[model samples]
Target: MRKFILCSALVLVMTALSGAAVMAAKPVDNDGDGVTERSDCNDNNALIYPGAAEICTDGLDNNCDGLIDRADPTCTAGVCSDADGDGYGFPADPSCSYTQEDCNDTLASINPGASEVCDNGVDDNCDGLTDTADPACGTNPHASNTWQNYPLDCLSCHDQQFNEMADSTHYWWVGDTTEMANQNGTLQGKLTNSVNSYCINILGDWPVCGKCHVGRGKRPDDPQADKTNIDCLACHNEDYAMARTRLADGSMAPSLAGVENPTAEELQVLDGYTQNINAPTRKNCLKCHAFAGGGNAVKRGDLSMSGTDLHGATLLEGTDNNSDPNFDVHMNVMASDLKCQSCHVFQNHKTIGRGSDLRPTDDLARGSEVKCVTCHAGFDVDGGHAAAGANRTDADRHVSKVACQSCHIDHYAKVATELNRDWRYSHDGTPADGTNGPGHPELTIGEDLSPVYKFWNRLSDNYLLGDVAVIDPETGAYPTSRPIGDINDGKLYPFKYKTGVQPMVSSDSKLVALDTYEYLAGSGDVDQAVQSGLVNMGYPSTEPVEWVTTDTYQLLNHGIAPAANVDCAKCHGDLDLATFSELDNLGYALKGPKAQICSQCHREKNLKSDHPGMHNHVDKGVGMDCLFCHSFSRQEERGGISPCDSNATDFVDTNPFAHPECSQ
Candidate 1:
């Protein structure tokens, strides 16, 4: 019985040991996680298990999928935040699926799709470069600006400029017509009676024409217009001048409609431009002046966006290089670097200069003239034109009868200029898309043009609103504007001779001012534009209309080349006299028979071959009067010195062979 009981006890012990082994083999819920030690990558941590969410910031793979943290698709480590709502994000994470990075997270306009702006000191397009450094900006880029409340906001600190501009001709568009020969001492200007070959006149085009005016919207000459109507930003801000559009109430407002799909550089944030207001730069002045007469470099031949090199590039289209200093010595950055105000010289908003075609004397007291002597005080003195191996005394002598620009400006319209505008036809108004076909008033452009020389006394006989249009017998075209003076009283000047074909009153022989605004803004019919102009001028719309050729002489003052670059042969040499008839046309014709004139000095001479000898005699301080051969006289400029007397023994001995033909 004892042996049997011991065996039973051993069996019972073995059975209990077997039950403990089975319990140890079963899965255990460690840390309350359902996963066993084999399946859980980390059984000790409850958050870490198979199929668990990955904690990217914690640097742990909670899912236990072999990938760690951000390596797993479940992690949001590479995602980015787009703060500006530009559909672009900053801090681009390669692991995340999102848009490219934004260089400027604060600006919605600063995206990868944006275009680079020039000279704004910003990486506007989210490119690595800012402003001019970017190749996309080009050598010369148009300036831009943005404003919240332009003129009114400017009044907080610029009340003085506002008051001054309010009284200026740029604002009023009218002043004393001090230089108009026909309308002298009258209150007239572009606002009332002014006329030109380009666009005809501004009588019925104030809304469109006034875009260049400094006023907000009303006619500058309106009695009710005041300082409140002045557009201070037009001069102070370049972008404002470019993007300004007429409002429903007749005031001007900066609108994005001026440009299509404009980038942030073109249409920037408002505070930057408004708060950083500065004095007008060349960019500001050119915003209106350069774009006058509808397009760039179209109207004024001398004054163009490429007139200066201040920005180190040419503003002209298709011109990518820096402007040559020879284009304009005074305005060249490498030379004088002078601003328009440097010569125009404004004081209290009253400018000192006005073209002969223009009608206002902003500051009558300051004078309505701009002379080279104002800056070059002693340019006429000895050694003024002296070079290393050349003597230009002959040029110095001519200065008394020749304006400085006549010789200095070798060519006008360095950029293409509209020499003629025929309004007999019309087309679509879109010039930007190149789909306008023939364009309104088909333009005739001239580039690098030699100026037409004329005698001017700073007085102009400009055709007025109701004045009878007189035909120039020389040109066989109506003279809309002409310089007034004879060779006896005037100095030789360079001019841009422009012509146009416009409607005229057949009965009255008066030129009609076509409504260019209506032609451009409304129906593109030139005939309808003429009828609108006639009605605006208080004439019957059915008034007998005739197309006549009209011409105007616009003075060329800017783009003065260096004195050393002047080609003397253009006017002085025998070669020029043979080809050019302007000299003889301007009363420089021989006063009498060449043989008789030469006999008075010495003996009979070959008129053409002896030209140099006759000029050499005058250069030797002979005090010979120009009237001896030419119709005009410079005797007064000779300081009362008498002409060469062949009777004198000293004259005979010193000038025995004065005439080259006689010497042979």
Candidate 2:
């Protein structure tokens, strides 16, 4: 009887198994996601369905549109998150009920958390109704202004925006510096570490430098991932000012030195924050840039307080109605409503255009967008241009090989600026505010100075914190900034010549950036500062140090001369002794190609020995066509003062007088 019952159960199980196999032959959700195969675009992904919102820029066909990347609008600008696939998204409350208020929209298990308890008549969430009377809330909820709850309150709402800022170079101060290939360190910037002619490295002086940093109260050692460290008001608030603490010695005390996090007392200063912050103003940027290297116009010769307002009422006329044309051409407000942002173009918080002395030169691996050619559009000028007289044929020939600022800018630092600053001399008294103002004494000021010219390919060898200082034997100083180029590499550029007298390790001959914050705040304790600075830079402080002078070059970008007033004879003359001597030293065959060919014209005409002979050559024999020596090409004759292969050591002369075909 037991065997017969077992047989009957086995038969029943066989019948059910056969029935399921037959049903499997039909269309089904193969990957086990909710929808059927035909309805689900990505049947394998349960999260992807016909009504699902799109993800962007990850090289995926998120919306099942076949197209990828930037082709989708979802990649451009969209809601930060929509984890639950609830048609409604979080972060962006789209008038739909399924937005952020629902804590776990995916698990319909949770909605908005229970409301605040009615212990008092106040509204915790700032809602209009009080406590129990508020219909939008429940009772017995826990909440406060504690740090534990802050992340959920703020970070959850704007995580993406914060992430963008956190990833930016402005925040990290350390990124891929492909532009600074010549530097010794892998990470670079004012934050990571840079040794400038002025102020030097910021390793031990975060509080002083942090005054200009975008983030709130962050020192050099702050964690890069701390989103709360961002200080939004610093750049946006017009009324927000950097309040500093000064010591009895008239030096600004470093705020929160050696402190990891800001205290409640430190935060109270920002309690009266401005709500309606605007875009960055000139005043905001100038607070730090204009005063770099200790004081106003101390580091950059092209920039000064005076250049900020170089425009006048007749600016649109393209003529200087208010002041000198050579002060500042681009930033003059009278000509247009332009600002620093106009040329510096910011995207995702990264500003374009780097200084020639800094990074982002023309040869940068991944280049910058800010450029003069953006608006100027090379060589398309008319008489309306300020430098209209510069359009002569002779000058136009050099345009391809010379930067505009090289010739147009006669001089820089129209206003007084420091030509040199020597920090080797010890100050025993109270340290002056060495960063700026009345106390610091190591400065040499100069005005209306001529710039040094160099062929710049936009490459440079910047000194790092520990590199051996490349000192000039004559000057006995290291170059803080130098532009690199060659005749075949790029064009001639004008730069402000700067010199500095600073400290260096005598034993290793390595350049050292001393920590001045502690020294200045400690009433000029040089020994303490040097030892601390060495420790901060990861070097032994036992090494002997000595004072040395160094030279740096900053490219001149201001003080453009009008073409109408510029005298061409200064650079271009048939036989001007001073002009020829200067051009020869700079590798220019300015005397009409060869010194030998020049004798042919003078000898044939028997021109006078004294006075300018360009008049005699042209008026008597060459028929005043000056084109013979100036223009490179005319109808049947070869012209131009220099050979086409300027970089070649030797070449067949291509002149009308020596032309093999013409002579025959």
Candidate 3:
């Protein structure tokens, strides 16, 4: 009985052990391709068995050998194409796996080796995160990938922006005008054969002028054909000034046109361009604009190298009066924190404001007009101080007659502006001699200069390339740049009067672009520069070159002062003042011995003069004071009352006993 019981127990134990073995060694086909789970390395994939055909570089393990994609031996050497030169690979076949590391293969600068850019709404480096979310591009302009390849790198993220800029005036240097246009309908651009009082023409020295351009290398053979040649770092990098320090003196300078190619030392300066990139700043604008006429403050009198923070903290105080050291009223750092972009807003990459001299007004397109009316109101409402006066009825009259800038901006070129430049006397082409003087000896500067006022219609009969300048008979010079206006056309405006001498072909007295390679490249080779310029312009060097005096009236657009009431004495000098051309245009005829207008209002039958005192009875000893018919207070307080009109009587209060007879 004991032997039979022990045998049954042993049978049960053996049965349990056999069941455990079967569970551990089970072989079920998951994909059901005739291969069991124990035989297939990738049980879930039917095509990925151990003996399956190897398709290398597919970003997948087809043969299931633990090695996958590009790392597999099946991928032949040189199968990976680094199209963008960023050192990443992508499969040419659609059925194969996409390049494992590179998100975008078409762009040579965007790859795993590229640095991520932030806030541009693109996965620039393609590490998953985009824009602000990218850890590699934090609050600072830091890119972990230390690669720098110019437009290739920038275009990886700013494709749309680059395309938009290609259409802008900043890029083309020519566009349809919003204010005025020439009769030919062909718009002028700085690049498209237009010349200026400063740096007359860029035709002969494209590479040198291109240094200031927002592009890399040099100007392309054709601007429209190569739109992708943008340099994002030129305008966006705040550290460009610091980076420029790496360049050898006069080595990479734009004026040194002979040095077309950059040396190793000059190329090092480009590395600084890759740092501290952000939006455009005043510094970026001044980089070219402030130094326009070849050196600091050479072009526009209103600009200088003294730094925008000339007044420092005093500008922001806004407590200054006439007695204080005058500062730039509008661009004062402390006053308003105004930057160049504040007023020249951009739309679709086209800036709102146009250059007064660069573009003609008659051909202007209109919508982008940058005027004072866009920001400030002309009249007062409710309790606010009226700009023109109370009710603005009288002050509003001047709105059509006078520009806001006429009374607001007192002067321009506060630091200094080039009053005249004689390139003939100073332009020897040898930079070391500086025959004229140090730092653009050709220029003569004038400090604290007042603007020349004129009545402008906003249209210009400007001279085009090769057009013979109309000589100013009286001045014996050429009016290369002038503003056109008449009493019926426009209102009074202010302008910077710039005069200089440039080359003109003597045969027909037409303008000619001189070879300025030495002036630009610092090579000091004038003969070669002239030869190159003549060749570029398709003009024969035999065409005798004559230096002609040229003048330009560039409009003043900045340096606005805080609003203050005008003194009555300013307009009404002697004889109660009424000798303004504005009054004559209004049909008043308030000039010498002309009493026709005064007799209409006054019962005095025979007033002899156009003087305001002749119309006032008190001045004539016949009746009351001048206040009876003239407003002596702020114009806004009296609701647009003219000093010589019946509206002035409206402000007479109960204390007006002296002029009661005339008031009634």
Candidate 4:
């Protein structure tokens, strides 16, 4: 019976399919020709005999007309006339009028060829005007920025702004500024507008001299031999560049005109959107300094590793291999590449003195390194900038010294992993953020990264916090606080430069060294530099250096608990082996104020997953500081010139961990 039923069903399906094959499609006919569609010569029109008026429609004889489709809209329709007349259609059919050939119906503009006037609110014909505002006049209203439409030429109201530019260093590149003695006291000098005037004279251009000369510009003498023009190629050169440049994996940031991103057909379009983004502003300086590495190192762009490196590896029991030498720094440096602007900023001490207080030059040339006393305001005072002048050795030092940017570069934004499609056309298209996780990072970024841990389950529920601890009711102190000053090492060696060990701090709160891109680029590594002549700034060696002491920092004694049961009785308890992982959440094993511990990472630049593991977690690359990567306990912050660190500590002599980037 089952066999019979299957055969019956198959027969029924076959019959239904056969019926569909015989049916034909529907038809279109402007003229009504009714010969049952199949036999009719013109399926659209019955009114057209073998020969009749050209009543259009049907691909045949409509009204017996020989023409096809050219009826109602053309000769046959009551208004027998072509509007476009190109033999096309009304709007599209170009038959009635060729004037319809004019593509732009709005401005009534016509013809394939015409003048190309950019819509810059101006009429170029010398025929006075723009956008019909002025009738083709001889001149245009110049670029203005005044309460009453002030013209671009500032002379309209003010005198030729500081015309002595021919003699000024800022205007013509000639010399240097005087220096001061200390950060405190009125760093005296002539507070005149003469220097300011020099800049205003040549102010018509984007570079007021002060724009790029950076340290000097209008402030110092740039000299004729080294007269530099503010050219785009100087910074955004494809091969050799000073400023960070951009390229598009997917046009995230096509090179600006004046900038490098150019097409083969033509170089930067004559004044395109290219020059829109401003020249090096203080903000631009920060962009490079904020980050490190291709992305690992950064300037103003800061990241949080707590200690975890770029690839998410942590210094735990089994991950960090001790045998390797560079293992620690390679793995834990946060934003390994540091930028110059990160430290050389306005109102910041790194500028010549401990603060806005700049001093004049002494008789020597150092990397301009000093703690408190540096820039004097002017050049005619007893102990002020008046006492300052170019140091005799300044020329040699400029030639030899790598002030910064010797390595790190603010790489342009990268194309994120996104679908390849014209945004308007994509089915599920999402615009990509110009930067990726690491490709473009800030050099000195702060994180509000609330999540402590994200387990393999791909969720944030299992995050860790540094080992939690409660204040002793008796003493309200926490393990973190400002570190006391110390002359860890008194003897000074002639200064030597080393790179790769990401920085953790600066001397006297000046420049945050390792935290910059320069540090990560392996600046003056030991092999490239002499491990000699480094001098110690602590010549008097007044204070004693202190080593890490758990007894001093109360939180260091406690530890983290397991992932799942983190909030239970485990949280309040004193640290033991089980609670150690909690440190991964708070981002450290240190027990100090956030500043004390935060600065640890603030120094180093690179932090890849491969660095020496610090605590006992996977180092998800989010919860760690610079110390976890630099083996900070071993390295010293160089203040006075020094070939090698006087306070360099040989960690564990029995090394417990190693960063991945460190080669033999």
Candidate 5:
């Protein structure tokens, strides 16, 4: 019995030793390949590792020629970092791959290279371009020589610059749609539907929402040609790019005539040229001067892309068209050398280089670019679209700190063109009171105002004011006034007969008039149908309809018609006032016994002509013009109300009211 027990113990010990050896063994190999877990590099594969010869497998590049896994994007984390970032790798683009292609993560389209059609707020991509087809080939801007009011692929010829811009955040659309444009937003439905929809839905599908799809090749009448601007080709093509054209006189026009308006034969010959287009000023961007510029969207954030560059040597001054390195607008400030790219780090901006992304607006890297308010939006410069008081709501709260392009992307100028007539009349906030309003005169409230933007006031000084007034020489009270008198009212409407009879005083708080019909009807708000008919018939809706006002009475302001509201007489003297025509029988302004406008402001003792000791204030008064010194002019100028004065009304007016005496 003892001998049997000892043998049994020995068997148990043997079993324990065998179990330990199995547990420590290498991973299981269904196919015995002589490789063990301890010696194998890829234990799962029968063939892999340092000594295993490479063979062609659809999964990877057996031979590396800068080609990865024989795929596109060249990624490891299932991402394709190759130029387009399509995850299938550098060569292949499996667009719908969740970890791989999701070309338009925000849109349903799975194509590569998509851009948002801003303003109208569309996603434009099948996987992008709001899900619209962004085929690699079409009437490509990069290939076409002619393009109008469209985004010509400016980078095609400027590959280096284009690459920089590709990863830049300056173009807000580089990011995906998020809180700013999703869920009930203007573009909500279409961005998600990944299909074309519109305000004009053609199939109720195409044309219905087609207005929003417009770009490079589109025309109001052509559906086949639009929507081609969603890719890099739209902006990089030489033919479509706006080259700074030199006129015969040596003046540079805004752009060379693009090949877009070609005749049929011309179009056929050009064949959507895909070549280099030379342009001016690869400049750095200039910060907008709210106190000095002209348009709402200046198109100059990247100064390097300007007509001229900062010349004093450095690239950061006013505008940085690097081509000239020293373009000179604000050279002294530019003297300090530092790349704005270095300071702002825009290239690494979180969502840069991406097309058709669908993230929220806030997700954009914060330091990507400087904001408009960063400089000009101090309480002083922020105001209404029409140089009015600040209401400070939408553009102020949510958007005030944003860049100008955040809202006016790609086609800012064209959009502004449509709204130009309707935003001009206000001095207080909101739009000036008309169907067609006024707009901010110059981009900045600098020294000048747009003629259309110079709001007409109760004290109307338009040339007709001379004839319409019942001037009681004793009272100097001229009530009925002309609209085209002293104000710049824009060269477009230097003279006009307004047919609109707004109650001379409107219950609607916005109206500022130079006697209704003379100014109002001519301001630009005609019946839409009437204007449309006139345009379609080629009957000239823009030709002056008020010949009486435009032809004869129009000569008063500057002794000639200045398209803008800049009144010559208003600045020069009484003889220069809008109504002071040298040929007028009334002999224009300030006639002899003419109640001395000068006497109103000067005490006989201080009159230089009469008082020998009076200081020379005449030249200062003569420096500009009568219109330059008016109460209204006083209001619009910077330091318009004397900086020395504590209150707006405290500034002394030459037309000072001694109402105490008038009361008598």
Candidate 6:
């Protein structure tokens, strides 16, 4: 009985093992491709069986081998015709596995491996993108897009633009001083011959001050300069001004400070900036102009970053008053939105507009002056100044004697400007902290200040570099720069008055062009700066020197406020205050006794009472001549004043302020 039970147990165990083998051998095809899942390479796809046909263009392993569609031995690689013999074929086939396809079959240079030729309206490379649209092309919108060779690469296709800029005042920093009364009809400029109250002069300071120049490394007038010295990116790229740094060799180069070994992501960002090229915007221009005298809004009182739109908003975040459009109507983003070039209008790189204090006449033809008449036509006529509740006739007559800026630009330095710079004291802050010690001069800045009034006739007496310094008898200060005009031939204009303490050569009384760069880069000593300056000016270092107070009058031509918003009482009402005091000081007083002059026309009138009415009686009431009591004549403007009787010559007998019939 035991032997029979053992034999039955063995049979039962064998049956169970056989059943397990049968279950394992059952066919498993999840995709239902008629092949087992183990045999198929891609079981999720029905077309990926082991012996399936390889479809070359599918980019897939149609036949389940160890290879993709193009690499399959069974698939025939498709070919295209190479008509241009450039080795690259046309009619790009996805099935072609041997080589990259060309975009244009007719031209051999239009192959996939070729370099892009910019501005030619041709796809030089077979990347389906052309010229500036190609990633390989640099920022240049013309041929030779590489920035490697610098200005030479730019000149390859932009020769005309290059030549135009080469002759421009912006590049040379000097030009014909046709408007200067001191150096009229002579070549004068700020490069090496002009002196001002700001940094004083450019002599012996080219290495530091020349960073703002458009040239590469040398001075603008350097004999070693060539076309390669031009920096095209200075005006074209907004970020270039801040991105540049002075090298050990005294040349300016794009800063690669933190990216010596750039990663792929950082390289992409740099490439994007290299490809960004555009016309000069306010942001681009303000980079140098707004920060002229070492800091923001330090030199030009009217020009500031707040004049721009998006960029200005970012720069003036904490300063809300500066960002107001009422500060400047023309440059206001919410208003006219005019650019610097809009009024200064450049033709072939020769700009048309310049202030009286500026030395160069960039456009000698004087095709256009940046005048209010350019936009406000008929401003000299009677109804030109017409407003809702204001007496505009008197305002219009004042246009003959007052500049638009005098009334419209009531205030200047919306952003603080350097009103005075004292070299005797050192600045005690971050910008002055350096290895050379604190060398920056102490600055007296003013913000939202009233402009000083002056009479100007578009002529200037700017101080030349080597000329002997002379003190103005009236102001008791050395006039580094001044406007040239009087009440007779000049109109009232606004000006920014600046002062500075500088060294003067006691032997010759000449203003020394102190080496401010030395004070900034070496030991912070004003005396050392003066010593270096004297030697550079062809004088002995031991030349006797004296500290002198110098002053300059820079023309305020920008920041035009709205005409309707002007306060007429600011000038006419307060005869003893600001405007009249300034006007009387500058020789705008009556030619003779005011009471005696009024008696000739009628009963003696109160000169101060009804000032507007009195002006109307002399101007529109009887058409009296302006020269009867003033230094200048408005006869031409009033159409040859009311004809007076030829026999009545004496002022006491004839009413010169009345018409012919009224005089009788």
lDDT of 4 by residue, 524-565 (tens): 131111111011212122222211111011000001111122
- Over the stretch 150-211, how does candidate 3's per-residue lDDT look in tens digits? 44666667788898887676766676754443443466767766776776777766655655
Q: What tens digits encode model 5's per-residue C-alpha lDDT throughout 517-572? A: 21222333223222332343234444222101110111111111111322233322
Q: How badly does each model clash, as a count of residue pairs?
A: 0, 7, 28, 159, 105, 0
lDDT at residue 262 of model 2 (Cα atoms):
66
Measured against the true structure, the TM-scores of the candidates, in listed sequence, are 0.69, 0.59, 0.60, 0.21, 0.24, 0.71
- Error at 550, model 4, angstroms: 19
Against the true structure, whose TM-score is highest? 6
Cα lDDT listed for each candidate: 0.69, 0.53, 0.55, 0.24, 0.28, 0.69
Q: lDDT score, residue 203, model 5?
A: 19
What overall lDDT, based on C-alpha atoms, would model 5 receive against the true structure?
A: 0.28
Decide which is better by lDDT, 1 or 5: 1
Model 3 Cα shift for residue 175 (angstroms): 2.1
Estimate the Cα RMSD of every predicted model relative to the unseen true structure: 34.2, 25.5, 29.4, 30.9, 29.7, 31.0
Off by over 4 Å in 3: 1-142, 145-147, 181-184, 220-228, 241-275, 307-326, 360-368, 378-395, 427-441, 473-476, 518-536, 565-664
Descending-TM-score candidate ranking: 6, 1, 3, 2, 5, 4
lDDT, residue 314, candidate 5? 26
Local accuracy of candidate 6 as per-residue lDDT tens digits, 55-87 = 443445767788874477664345345544456
The local lDDT score (0 to 100) that residue 153 gets in candidate 2 is 40
- The window of 10 residues in a row where model 6 has the poorest summed lDDT is 310-319
Please give, for residues 211-250, the per-residue lDDT of candidate 1 as tens digits.
8887777886678877778877677666666667786666
lDDT of 1: 0.69
